[model samples]
Target: MNSLTHSSTSVVRKASRFLLTSRRFCDTSRINGDEETLKITWETSEMDCGFAEEHEKISVRRTFLESTKLSASQVLDTLKQDCPGFNTKLALDELNVPISGLLVREVLLGILRRLSFDNKTRCAKLAYKFFVWCGGQESFRHTANCYHLLMKIFAECGEYKAMCRLVDEMIKDGYPTTARTFNLLICTCGEAGLAREVVEQFIKSKTFNYRPFKHSYNAILHSLLGVKHYKLIEWVYEQMLEDGFSPDLLSYNVVMFASFRLGKTDKLYRLLDEMVKDGFSPDLHTYNILLHHLATGNKPLAALNLLNHMREVGVEPSVIHFTTLIDGLSRAGKLEACKYFMDEMVKAGCTPDVVCYTVVITGYISGGELEKAEEMFREMTVKGQLPNVFTYNSMIRGFCMAGKFKEARLLLKEMESRGCNPNFVVYSTLVNNLRNAGKLLEAHEVVKDMVEKGHYVHLISKFKKYTRS
Candidate 1:
C-alpha cells in the first residue's frame, strides 16, 4: 500500500503484458521439444501429474523400462513370501496384528514404477484385493499414503468404479480424507489421464455421506493448476469457499500461481490483497512464483527490482531468484546483464547451480553466441556442476544451427559418455541439418539411430507403408 508496493504493482502489470508471447515463454525449446511429433494422449495438459514440469523424451522413455530384476508380480510374490501370514492375518477380523503398513505398500508401489504397463494393469487387481483384505482387519490399518498407492493403481487401470468403492470403504472405516489423500488422487487424475472427470467423481462422493476435508479441496485446486486447467482451478476454488473452507495461505498461493500461469494479473493482485486481509502473509514460495512470472515475462529489470522488495519484506532472495533474472536478461539479449547478475548472485552469497549455468547457456545459444555458451558449459563441468541432458541438448542444437555438425556430433558422444542420453530433439536437429546439407547417407543413419532409440519416426513409417502398398 506504500510507494514500494505501488511501484511493484506497475512492474508486475507491465511484465504481464509479455504473457501474450509468454506461453511459448521466450524459448522455442520450451514448447513440447519436438513440436511436430504426435501426442499419444488426449489430455489438455502436457503434464502427467499436471503440476510437475515436463521431462525430456529420453527421461520419459526411461521411466517406462521394465525392471530386469523385479517384475511387479514378482514384487507382490515377494511380499507374500516375506510376510507369510500377512494377507491371512489381514483377512481375519478381531485380530490385532502389528503390520509394517508403509513398508509393504511402498514395496508394491516401487515395483509399479519398474513394471511394464501390461504388468501394471495386471497387478492392479492383485493390489485392490490386497488392500480390500487389509482394510478389513481390526489391526491392519492402511495409512493415507497406502490409500494413495492403491488409488494410483486404480486410476491407471481406469477402474473408476473400484476407486469409488474404495473411497466409500475408506470413509466408512473412519479414514481421514485429508489434503494428502486428495493431492495424490488429483495427481492420479493427471497421470492416469482422467482429466476433469475425476473432479466430478470426487464431487459425486458427497452422496456417500462423509465430506472431504478442506485440504482435499485445496489439493484438487492445486492439481488443476498443475495441468493449466485455469478456469477449473477458479471453479474449484470458489466451490471450496462456497462449501465453507476459508482460503488458507496454500490456497492463495495455488490460485495466485494459476493466475500468473494464465496471465490474469488482476486476479493475482486481488488474491494477494485478499490473502493479507485474511491474516495470511505471502511466504518465500509466493514470492518465488512471482519472480518466475516476472522473469518469464521478459521483465528482467522488474524481476531484479522485486528482489529489493523481497529484502525490504525480510524474505531472503534465493539462487532461484538470481537464476530467473539471469534467464530473463539472457532472453532479452543482455548477455552482459546475465554476467552481471551471475557475479551479483555470488556476491549475495548464494551459489549458482547447474540450472543457472544451463539457463545462461541456452540464452547464449539462442542469441548465436555459441562460443560463450560452450565456455559456460565447460566451466560447469570444471566446477563439478554435472550438466544434465537439457544442457547437452542445448549445445547440440546450437551447433546444428550454426552448421557446426562436427561439434554437435562430438557433443552427442560426450553427453552419452557422461551418461546423459541424447533425446529425440538432438537427433531430429542433426537429421534435419544433415539432410539440408546434402549428407543423405548421414541423415538416414541418424534417423535409424533415432528409431532405435525408440522414436516412432512416424513419417518414415508412413513412407515405408506407402511403398509396401
Candidate 2:
C-alpha cells in the first residue's frame, strides 16, 4: 500500500509542477494546447491492503524499476530543467544524474507510459533524444527491448518519422530486430496504410530469423489495398508466395482488387478461380466487388444476373448490394426496370435504404417522371429517411430540366432554410433553369447571389453573357 501510494503521488506531483510553471512552459515544444487530466481510480490490490502473501510472482526489484505513467508536460519540464538541450551532447553530459544512470533511463522511459492526449507526440521526441544520447554513452547501450519499446511509443502515436529513425538506429547498432519488433512495425505500417513502408518493413523482416508470416502479410496486403498500389500489391502477393507463405482469403481478396484495379479482367477472374480452388470462399466484400464492377460498367442486366447468381450461390444480399444494382439501373435511364428491381429486392427481404430511394428517385427524375420522383422524395421524408442535399439537388435539377422554374426556385429556398446550404449544383441549376425559361433578370439575381456567397465561377465568359442579356 505504501509503495502504491508513493508511486501514484509522484505522478500527480509531476503533473502539478507543469501547471504552476505557466511562463517557462510557453515557447516550449508542446503537442497542441489541449489539456488532459490523468485519473487513477484503481488503487492497491487486496494483497497490498491486507497481509503480504507467502508467495507472489511479483519481484519488487523489477516492479519498482518498471516505468509508470507521468504527465507529458511534467516530462518536458523535467527534461528542460534537468536535461536542458536534451538533444545536445554537452547537456546530456552536464546533467547531475549520470547520463547512463537507471534513474535517467527510467525518466526517459516513463515519458512513454500511459501518456495523455497532447502528451504523446512531444513525449516521443524526448524519448528519441534519450535514445540518441544512449548511443553516445559507452555505459548505456540500448537493449533490443529498449529499441522495441521506443518504436512502440512512436508507432501508437502515429509518429512514423520518429519510428523510422529508431528502426534505422536499431539496424545500425547491430541489434537483431526481434520478431516482436518486426511484426509490430509491419502491422503499424499496414494499419496506417503506409503503402511504401509495408514492403520496406517486410524486406527488413527478412534479415530477422523470426518472420511473422501470417498477420504481417495480411496487414501489408490490406494496407496496399487502401493506397490502390496495384503494382506493389501484385509484387507483394508474388513475393509472399515466393517466401513459402500461403495466401489466405484476405490475401486473395487483396489480389483480386489489384487485378480489378489494373484492368486485368482475365487476371481478376483467375484470381477468383484460384480463391475457390484454394478452398477459401469469397466473403460479402468479394461478391460486392463483382456487383460493383457490373454496376459501374452500366450493365444493369449483367448486374441483376450477378445478384441472382449471388442469391443462388447463397450470398444474402444486403440493402447496400441491392442499392448498387438499383443505382446501375437508374443510371441506365430504365425507370421501369429499376423500380421492378427495387420491388424484387424488397420481396427478397432487403428493405430499401435512403440510398436506394435516392437512386430510384434520381432515375425517375432522369426519365422526366418528376411527379413520381416528388412523391418518393416526400415518402422518404415521411419515413424519416430525411432527404439530404443530393436528394434536394436531384429534385431541383429535375424541376429545372422540366422547365418548372417556380418549383425549382421554391425548393432552393426550402433547402437553404433547412440549413442544407445548396451547393454549386443547386445554384447553377436554378440560374441556368431561369435563363433557359427566359427569366433573364431572375437568373442575373441568382448569379449575383452566387458570387456573394463565394461561389467560384468556372465559366466567366458565360457569366458575362448572362449579365449582358
Candidate 3:
C-alpha cells in the first residue's frame, strides 16, 4: 500500500465508527419520544370522557354523544352496560379513570331528569355536583332538557341561584329559551320579593331571540308595579301587541292592577272589557284584587259591579273575595251594606278575621254608628281575637265623634291595659275628642306627651288645636 491510500483508509474507518454510534443514539431517542406522545394522547382523550378505563373511555363517550336518537331509558341502558348504575356521583368518583365530556353530560342529563321527576333529593344533589363538573360543555339538547328539569326541581327545592345558573347555561348552549321559562323564573323570584340575581338573569335573557310570553309580561308588569314604574308598565303592554303574543287572562289582570294603581279608571274598564271579549272570565283572585283596588281607590261602586260580575260568571267567591268586597264598601262609607256582607260571609261558612272586623268597625265609626262599632269590638274579644290598634282607634274616634268622651277614655285605658301601646293615631284620637269636648287642658297634656315621646302626632295635634281655636 502507498502512503496516500493508507491515510484515506484510516479516515474511512473513523467515519464508519462515528456513523454507527450516532445512528444508535438517534434510534433510541425517536422510540422514547413516540411512546411518550402516545401515552399523553391516550391520557388526554380519557380525561375528556368522564372517568372510565382509558381504553373504554373514548368508545363510551362517542356512543353517548351519538345518543340523541336514543330514548333516555335506552341511553341509560347503554350506560348500564358501560358503567353499570352510572349516576353522576359515580362518574365524578371515577376521577382516576376517564370518560369523555359528552358522555359525562349524558349521564348527568339522565340522572338529573330522573331525580327531578322522582324528587330524590340525594340524587338531585349528586346530579348538581356532576353539573358543576361538566361545566358549560353540555350539548344544546341536553342543556335544554336538563334546565327544564332543574326548573321544576328548583321550584320544589326553592333553589333560586341554581335555577338562574341553569338558565344561563341553557342560553350559552344555544338552546332556544322562551318566555315561558323566563316567566317561571320571574314568578318564583317575584314571590320571594328579594331575588335580585333572578331579576338580573331575566334582563340578560331578553338579549336572546326568545320572545317574552304573556305570563312573562305579567311578571315584568308585577316587578315594575313593585317599584311603581307605571310608565314602563304602559310601554310594556304596547310592546306586547307588537311582539305577536296575545295577552291572556294573566295579562289582563296585570293591566287592570297597573291601571288601578295609576287611578286610571278608564284604562281599567277597557282592559276588563278586553278580557271578557277574549272569552277569559275573571277568576276569584281577579275579582278580589280588583275589588280591593276599587274600594281603596275612588271607585267603590265599580268594585260592586265587578263582584256581581264575578258571581254571574260562575266563579265561587272565597273568604278573601268577600273580605275585599266588604273593605271596599266600608271605604265607600256604606256601613249597612258592609254589615250585610259580613253576615253573608258567615252564613257561607267563611270565618271573618281581624281585618274584616276592622273594616266593619271603621265603617260604623264613619257612619256615626258608635253603638254598632262598640258591639263589634265586644264580638271581636268574645271570639278570642284581640283588637288590633286599628280596631281600638276606630272605636275611640267613634265615641269622640258621638260626644262620648268618657267612653273613649275608658277604651283608651283598656287598650293600654291590654299592652297595646298607643300609636300616634291613638293619642290623636284622644286629644281631638277631649279638646272638642271643651277639655283643652287634657288635650294640651296629650300633645305634650306625644311630643316628648317623639310620636308623629304633631300633624293631627296641630289640626285639633286649630279646630278648637
User: Among these predicted structures, which one has the highest lDDT?
Assistant: 1
Q: What is the TM-score of each candidate against the true structure?
A: 0.64, 0.49, 0.46
Each candidate: RMSD: 20.1, 21.1, 34.0
**TM-score, structure 2 vs. true:** 0.49
lDDT of each: 0.68, 0.68, 0.65
Worst 10 residues of 2 by lDDT: 34-43
Can you write out model 3's per-residue Cα lDDT over 204-281, one digit (the tens) per residue? Answer: 465433434435556666666665656557867787677677887767777777787788867876777677767776
Candidate 1 per-residue lDDT over residues 38-121, each given as its tens digit: 443534355565545445555654643433223334445544433334553333322322334744465557645644545655
Off by over 4 Å in 3: 1-220, 223-236, 239-248, 260-266, 276-281, 289-315, 436-438, 448-469
Best by TM-score: 1
Which runs in model 2 stand beyond 4 Å of their true positions? 1-214, 227-232, 296-309, 364-372, 399-409, 416-469
TM-score of model 1 vs. true structure: 0.64
lDDT tens per residue, model 2, 88-121:
5455455433433454446555766546566676
lDDT of 1: 0.68
Model 2, clash count?
0
Tell me the number of clashing residue pairs for each predicted model. 1, 0, 9
Comparing 1 with 2 on TM-score, the higher-scoring candidate is: 1
Of models 2 and 3, which has the larger lDDT?
2
